[model samples]
Target: MQHILNRMIVQSMETDRSWFEGDLMERFLRYVRVHTTSDPHSASTPSTERQFDLARMLETELRSLGSTDVTLDEQCRLIARVPATGPGDPIGFMAHVDTAPDFPGEHVNPCVHERYDGGVIELGGGFTLDPAEYPMLSRYTGETVITTDGSTLLGADDKAGIAEIMTAVAYLTAHPQIHHPEIEVIFTSDEETGRGMDGFPVEKLRSGFCFTIDGTDEGAVEAECFTAYKATVSFTGYSIHPGSARGKLANATSMAATYIAMLPRSESPEATDDRYGFYCATEVTGGISKASATIILRDFDHDIVKRRISYLEQLARTIEGSFPGGKVDVNVDRQYLNMADFLAPHPEVLDRVRKAIAATGMEPVIHRIRGGTDGARLCERGIPTPNIFTGGQNLHGRYEWIALPAMVRASKTIVNLVQLFAG
Candidate 1:
């Protein structure tokens, strides 16, 4: 362990000299500047052509680092293998290369706050990440942080994960005598647009177990995620002139609003935590002639998730038939299921991860993910994957920032897991 740590420290020191000090921040800037945001409407494998830019760059880096079978597939997913020092089940590190479409991820100007004083750090001249406004910043006082320049998102959500993985892989490859088992490295595209693993081949991945380095804070280890379902409600109402529409007009928008009002206020993302479930009204648009609503139901409990979807469908049916001339359409789609159901059967994977985390001199916090992750999908596909932290906060917004020390810790954790699983 000490030998491995010594190698990591030396490699990290070398990385610090030429963009290594700012390597993660610089890598993050280069990636976010390429405009790799996915389009939900596009049919392409990557959903965006610009994603190929980062994909090609990563492929080059992997090859340069002596990784074998480094290839960027037609789907824009990059895969490579680092030969193990001894016989052991392959371990993998995974992250997405795409940013969310909800924000402008292109031309990102990432700014560094060196030795942050834990105050309101201005991004540009206008936007700022104030500790008072965001108390999470207080946790990283005296540590270097990376943030955006108020023009675009920093893309640290997963880019941070990418950098951490890259640095760890580079560390292991540069020092072959560190005694590690077979390691697989994967970077997927279009994670933001909900199709991250749409075409993912789980059977092809050679890892016995995996963990996503995509959580907030340094000590959080997420083993479960919400079972998510989407419910769409469409309303059809009679369109009539106001003068003669007194009893004829169904007012679909009003009915939609009524349905929204009926959803329990206490059950919302803002009102819940840990194992609590919620109904979130994501989008609503309507008129007297037609109206539609998109709602998301989330919970960790399979039964609760099922009950919420049923409640939504039943309510929509009642609302649809409420008026003689009014009609409603309801569609419920199961987006993803909780991984705990599958992971419980594979307790060894969790035990190995817990052991790896504890070896880092930090107590592991095994918490449930409030939102679904690609790991949830991977678990369902056969690999019982969990989530580790990337030390990022306020993801998907301008307030996003990452602590440099925490990022280093993440790299160390990855190395520890690889060694612990190595035979």
Candidate 2:
């Protein structure tokens, strides 16, 4: 029965010329221009009001495309169902609506280079994406590429994913003869701030399996990701007049600096890659009397993350003991864990993805993500979700770009996955 449904869908798609002419690039460009950068300091679900702008737009677009159950929640998460025409388990595709706050995401002007020549492409502000520096450009030599004007990030990290998912759903909706199970498309907000799934109601989704189209590179599927923790260390010191301050003053700023110095320099983010762990000091601020530092610990091994937390605690105690009149406090919070642990038991999840990528005429490139995605949190909540690529490069910065042809292939991969699952 499933095979029959798949065959009918394929035949219908082949007969419909409009299915191949969907405008994925236009959707992506429209999304990136909205300036939906998430804020880490906001105590809200979306972390930014502008995120709702994109959410509302996506909600309207999904309804126009004939999607059912299309709803945008207060948290700025937009979910809609592409109703199935045949029997199969419901599948979900997710992508975040917010871009990273590390760089500016306002007033984005995208540059379209049709049939890119393999050479140094000059973005404004003296930033050039040289093929010698980023050899990936050579691989995308003849393909159309979309980049920023060196003033703001392109937001292609997940917007490309969102566009691809939207394009695939639009195609599936137009061709009703393409029989498959229901598909839940979720556009999340604040993924860059690490709260994309914080308020998401997974039980309501009813999807047995899902995919987060939030990674970089083409043909890459990530099943494993870093176990993460965020740590805050605060220091209190005695303030005294410098003229009579001998043995009477302990500087809080100095204490914070000492704690950072104690962290392993060779094990920092700039030094580690490919399965190695890191302890990074992300922010530090305050006066001599009081200071605080924010640090993040990441590793594929849960035990290593625990060890890093213990080390921070031990360092805090040592600093307190040395400063006689000063005090130090350390707090650690678990963010997310390696999705591989949750996905390992379910081999079919990734196996199906491998087959789907191959169906797009590309070999599946299996790799572990050095960072976590919203999919990791979903997998922990009993939904087996792995990550697929969005054809983005140099994400979270002015040099970010997307290969247009690769983006098209990613959309095809989504369509193929639906058909494969139906069978």
Candidate 3:
């Protein structure tokens, strides 16, 4: 039945000039329903076993798409090699299968609009997707826009990316006459938790450059991202009965709250945009006896990142001093560095992205990622990967949406990027 539905969809798409558009749309809808939300606290490679669901599905799909050397490793990275028609080293395209844990990722019911009317869209749960609130939707008017039902995230953060890659792979297999070099297609897991590239085997890639299809908006190209750090502050206190509590009992929860309170509201994720960096408190948990808080510090400048780290360390000491009997510990873990330095030598990497977007008839908008992508670590590891757009909006939330036409353009951009690499 599923195969029949797939064939029907493809057959319907055959009527369209860009046959891959229907495939990209269906692929995204199917992938998001698989429940691949990742866990941040998990020590495992994928951070969640369920991510294997999409990985396994893509592995089989890639083989069926005429892709060679397809492999889904234990770490939940599904890689496939598209044999070269001409001759050159393979260039890679990547996206993540895992959805963000910030919102409900399971049982996603997407609302597909054939042609938006440029009015308010009533997503359920009293959440209305108003064009006034999101000016980006104005551009999507009169287009096929996919959105959440207001119950779960649309998961277009990277599913749209996955769909674009899959559609491009399908396009390549269908059109062998279009000259191109060898292509590597990679889909990763746990990207939402910022550990997608953990122990990434750089040796696996034969590509001199890779493009991550994980950006938002149309014609977006990103070559840089914030240097990220994971800082955990642990608070320790004495657990005592309320009858004997008084001043003798030191409250760890209070200490954690105090530390959080010390964070500047003006220097938070909600407070900043573009190249400006900030500290984000992701998680806080504990009782009076023990507790811990997880905060992510990000800056485009390494020196600023260093200063942020130092500030956090000093803040921990201050909290300890205030608690007296309570204990505070701050552990800062380097996540990924700014990819700009690593990619500085390769101007063509970004140049080709511009050319590709231009070939798709859109003006490429170059920007910096306020957050990081799997390509960030890959860039630092010598692949010199940059990111291209996936047509996503309001990512990681129930209000998330995407324009189907934009993703189709992105797929063509990938095809163009592949050909440019051959040249």
Candidate 4:
């Protein structure tokens, strides 16, 4: 019976050999297993030392693949150059290596659901993914999908992106006669922490434009994304004994609550979508003596984003004015700018992606990312980077998953994109 099962496995492999091309699935599995979660609170370059494990592994793999000019810097950014054959414009591909801190990114045990039937799927640890909640699962019928064991996130958010980019690198290397440009591939660190591109050696890149393989949905070509900022609103107040508090005490936490109360419910993330900007309070903490809240502002329009920041600053002042002994301080920092601002002038950049997606028999989706990627920062640095899909869904969570066939199409899209740049 065991021999019969082995023969069946061999037969399946023979029938679906194309699905395993470039070892995309195998690479993704290996990458997700590594604990590379980035810390948003850390002041370090990678935000976590564990990220270097994957960085070193990728460096070694690139060396073994005969890739040249490979380097892993102090910031944990890994870059590898694929020499051009029959020269054309240099192009680049990027993907982040660190998993999100939104959930447990350690001990990622990926489970393969072969030939999914578009139904509720069981993930261990008392978690089950329902098609009713995640409609995207319905689209993967008849395709192999990967999910976690419900203990931790699947890490498809960027690991899958890394796998797809590596597949492209491997393909372009073996098929040197494919007529391509000098390809620069980078694996970024701490993208989930929202500061991955900080100190990234963008000056070293030869590509005038690049694509970040950090998007969701199959065949997605993203040029628009949120212009992001993180704001910390801290409050200070005088504390007194309860008997004397009535007239002498200024409660800092109450001041914070007042500021939060002033935030418009209609203008929040839960209430907005598709080009609508939002102010989301991610963290709130303190006692009567001290209090603070972390809020993120996001919008597509530069003017609107500025207005939102102004609103935050004004609100802080108003909150302070309400209490004579209370002080409120708002500090806003730019996270990333929208990529469309840089990519719009390059219609040819978008056109090439559409053609490549079409070449893989999938219609290209001109998408707007509600969040940002490493591409946004690269674009800001004059690289004009856009985003491409990795066929991931429910990203940054335990319910995350990806379609095997979708990844194959994406891999094919990258191959075709490289050729399209040849002219």
Shift of residue 326 alpha carbon in model 4, Å: 4.1
lDDT by residue (tens digit), candidate 4, 1-423: 011112332344335447554389889999999999999999989899999999999999998878889999999999998887756888999998899999998989999998898889999978999999998888888878899999999999899889988887787677666667788889989998878888888889989889999888897888999999999999999988878787678899999998988988999999998889999999999998999999999999989989989999999889878887999889999988999999888988898888778767788889888988888888888999988998999988988998888787777677778877874
Clashes of 1: 3
Q: Give the top-scoring candidate (lDDT).
A: 2
Q: After superposition, how far is residue 394 of candidate 1 from its true place, in Å?
A: 2.8
- List the pairs of residues colliding in candidate 4: none
CA lDDT of each prediction against the hidden true structure = 0.80, 0.87, 0.86, 0.86
lDDT of 1 by residue, 128-242 (tens): 7889988888888998888988877778778888888888788677767666778888899988888878878776789978788888877788888889899888988888887
What is the RMSD, in Å, between candidate 4 and the native fold over all Cα? Answer: 7.1
Candidate 1 at residue 329, lDDT? 80
Candidate 1, pairs of clashing residues: 15-20, 16-20, 16-21
| TM-score of every candidate relative to the true structure | 0.85, 0.88, 0.83, 0.87
Clashes of 2: 0
RMSD of 2: 3.1
Error of 3 at 86 (Å): 1.7
Cα RMSD for candidates in order = 3.9, 3.1, 6.6, 7.1
Candidate 3, 64: how far from true, in Å? 1.7
lDDT, candidate 4, equals: 0.86
Clash count for candidate 4 is 0
Q: Write the per-residue lDDT of candidate 2 for residues 118-197, one digit (tens) a residue.
A: 98999999988888988998998987889999999999978999999999888877667766789999999998998888
Runs with alpha carbons beyond 4 Å of true place in candidate 1: 1-33, 40-43, 113-122, 131-142, 236-258, 287-290
After superposing candidate 3, which stretches have Cα over 4 Å from the reference? 1-16, 41-43, 122-127, 233-273, 279-295, 311-330
Steric overlap count per candidate: 3, 0, 0, 0
